[model samples]
Target: MTGTVTCEPGTPGVPGTVGTSGTPGAPGTPVVRRNRRATRPAPAGVDPRPSQHALTSRASEDRPEGWGDASASKQVSSYDAELQRDKPPHWG
Candidate 1:
């Protein structure tokens, strides 16, 4: 995202003939200045936060299709088991 300040044309200063003359009016087109934020990609070893749906999918990847028969507690344990056994420390 960027923040931009644009200068709009308004009344010009009174024309000066004595002493230091006032600067001329701005050009016909407005002046545009953009303040852009610096954006950098995450490092290779770092992991982005996963969505809830993604977490659920990874947790259940090893389960059978009709896993509804399993008790809720069993399902949770299986999911944790899969993550523990399959994922390395750096994965997260």
Candidate 2:
């Protein structure tokens, strides 16, 4: 005889066919378990760190105006100037 076992969501247990000894089937079968973590609030005075977006915005505000755009343009222009400088005079 052949049979299939199924489990429901959020149910923590193993699903398998019952053997002749009245015990669950082989240990190779998969089992579902609950996450036993504490959900209690933090201790009295601790503060969670700032979130990623908040930290990023704070860093951006600390930078000089137009710093990102200016840096990117400077990189491109410097690369182009270097390439031009390396070329033979006759190739210009």
Candidate 3:
């Protein structure tokens, strides 16, 4: 016979091996894993995550007084902040 060498067909790649889109992994159904974290009770009379609408009067309650309306996106700098305490003289 003439010199013609033909090898077996190459094995097919996994489903999601090529291209720019589609799910991660082998391109099949997704598998959801379980979360091992355990929930615990917080402070008393405080509903950390209130389920009812009346629980939180306004979602922006944590925001500063002037940080409302169009000014919400502006960067805020506090000039009279008191939480910072004076450090002891050592590296001076």
Pick the lDDT winner.
Answer: 2
lDDT by residue (1-92, candidate 3, tens digit) is: 23322222231443333322343332343323446579988799987777653643545755565364335565544532321234345634
Q: Using TM-score as the measure, what is the rank order of every candidate, best first?
A: 1, 3, 2
Ranking 1 against 3 by TM-score, winner: 1
TM-score of each: 0.24, 0.21, 0.22
Cα deviation at 29, candidate 3, in Å, is 25
**Which lDDT tens digits does candidate 2 get at residues 1-92?**
13544333333444444432334453334333446667876676854443433433445645554464444335457777797789998896
RMSD of each: 14.4, 12.1, 18.1
Better of 2 and 3 by lDDT: 2
Per-candidate local distance difference test: 0.47, 0.49, 0.43
Ranked by lDDT, the better of candidates 1 and 3 is 1
Candidate that would win on TM-score? 1
Q: Local error of candidate 2 at 15, Å?
A: 12
Give the Cα error of residue 13 in candidate 1, in Å. Answer: 17
Residue 4 displacement (Å), model 2? 16
lDDT of 1 by residue, 1-92 (tens): 23322232344442321222232224333333455569788788865544433443534646653565455465466777786789987987
Pairs of residues at least 3 apart in sequence or in different chains that clash in candidate 2: none
